[model samples]
Target: MKILITGGAGFVGSALAIALKQNYPHYQVLALDNLKRRGSELNLSRLKAAGVEFTHGDIRSKEDFDALPAVDAVIEASAEPSVLAGLDGTPDYLINTNLFGTVNCLNYALKHKANFIFLSTSRVYPIKTIETLNFVEEATRFALSDEQPVPGVSAKGIAENFPLDGARSLYGTTKLASELLIQEYNEFYGLRTVINRCGVLTGPWQMGKVDQGVMVLWIAKHYFQQQLGYFGYGGTGKQIRDMLHVADLYRLIDWQLHHLDQVNGEILNVGGGLESSASLQELTQVCQEVTGHTIPIKAVAETRTADIRLYVTDNTKVTNLTGWKPEIGIRRIVEDITAWLAENEKDLAPILK
Candidate 1:
């Protein structure tokens, strides 16, 4: 099978390409990326070393997709991925790349009769709704309130059916809009499209910036003794997020590819869930324990735009359907990222600057 991964040189995209090659040696994997992200260019060698073909191209341009040969499947993983995008400037680039880029990808898939997989964000859920989720604070993190029983949510966390009613930020708006377009494409053209709303996907090879890859950013900051700050929400740093390692996503994608027929047109909340969640404080403790250092962190009393309180993936649906659950916990996430950063500290010197 010939497969194309958009944003192929990115952390998630490159990891998927490498993992796919290892698991399915007979399949040819091609990755196309603009290398616009600060650390994206670093993945070119990694992808090439893994026997994955690389193309320096942007998904925002239809000509890039036109250059590719017909493939059996397309993994649409390209995006800006910053929730704060467009708040300080125009969101045109985010919309053009994420929403319109999917349109271009769908056109490419239609031409090739290839199946489509959209790597969407959990941010598609409304920000107001999430911010309103009833929670009580503990020593280091927050948990759901027993007084309120949110539909599609429990101690396990938010599910696919979580309410979607308010502004989800410019980044999320683009992804949700793209999802609608994908559904339309599937219905009108009978295109086999599957959507995975993933939350906090991270691991090695991630050139994490402040706006994206927060988990990786946290670890890198701690390991390198970089100054850290907790902004907004009184700077309590109690805001919670669940993390899922990229390797676990590889396992799920493999199963989905083999059983596309069964999972077609399905939207699953794919993530590490409550079992793998942690707060900034909890994360700091772990980093201190793992790296054995007191990483200084400041409390900035202003919250950033579009920042939410807590988000945990409820993987029950995907777990029941495909028997897939995250195997990498927060500790392993710290270990792998720490090891990768230490080894690639020289190569990543420019971005880490």
Candidate 2:
């Protein structure tokens, strides 16, 4: 089988490409990336070393896909990814890349008759709705109340049936819009497609930043003895999110490829679930334990408009169908990232620190 991965040089994209190639040497894998993210260019060598072909191209341009050959599948992983994007008065890049670029990818898939797999964001759920969830404050984190006033949410976390009304952020808006488009393509064009509404996905090689990939960002800050801050929810550092290792995601995608008929037209929520969730304070403690650094963290009472206090995926839907669940816990995720950072300190310090 031949595969094309957009954002192929990115953390998730590159990791998926390398894993697929390593596990199935007979499968031809091509990774196309614009390398817009800071540390993405670093993955070119890793991709090549793993026997995955790399192409420097932007999905925003239709002409870029003209040079590529037909593939059996197209993994749409390219996006701006930052929730804070366009708040500084620049929506062009986020919208064009996340929405328009997806359309271009869809066209490419249509032309090739390839199965489409979209990596959508959990941000597609309304922020206001999630904020309304009831929770109790624990010493290190916030725990969801057993009962929720909202549908499709509970202590188990947010489910696939969560209501999708209200503002979720410009970054999320584009992804949700793209999801609608993908559904249309699947219905109208008869393209086989599956959408995974993923929560925080992190692992080694992710160039994490404050706006996204906060798990790795948290570890990186502590690893280098850098100061950190909690900006929302009265600055108590109680905001929480579930994390999924990229390897776990790769396993699911691999299974989906083999069982596309079963998962076709399915929109499932994917994440590490409640078992792998952590609050900022909890993550800080873990980071301190792993990195052996005790850095002071500043707390600000003001909440970012685009920020949500908690988002855990209830993976019952996907788990039942695919029999897949994230095996890596928060500490394990941190350990892996720490190891990667330590191994490549000389090369990563400038970017991560």
Candidate 2's TM-score = 0.99
Kindly give the stretch of ten consecutive residues in candidate 2 with the minimal lDDT sum.
Answer: 141-150
Give a tens-digit lDDT track for model 2, residues 55-127. 8999999999999999999999999999999988989999999999999999999999999999999999988
User: In order, how many clashes per candidate?
Assistant: 2, 0
Candidate 2 deviant stretches above 4 angstroms: none
Best by lDDT: 2
lDDT of each: 0.89, 0.94
Model 2: colliding residue pairs: none
Candidate 1 structure quality by residue, lDDT tens digits, 269-310: 999999899999899989988877787799998877788888
Q: Candidate 1: where are CA atoms >4 Å away? A: none
**Worst lDDT window (10 residues) for model 1?**
146-155
- Candidate 1 whole-model C-alpha lDDT, 0 to 1: 0.89
Which one is best on TM-score?
2
- How far residue 312's Cα lies from its native spot in candidate 1, in Å, is 0.4
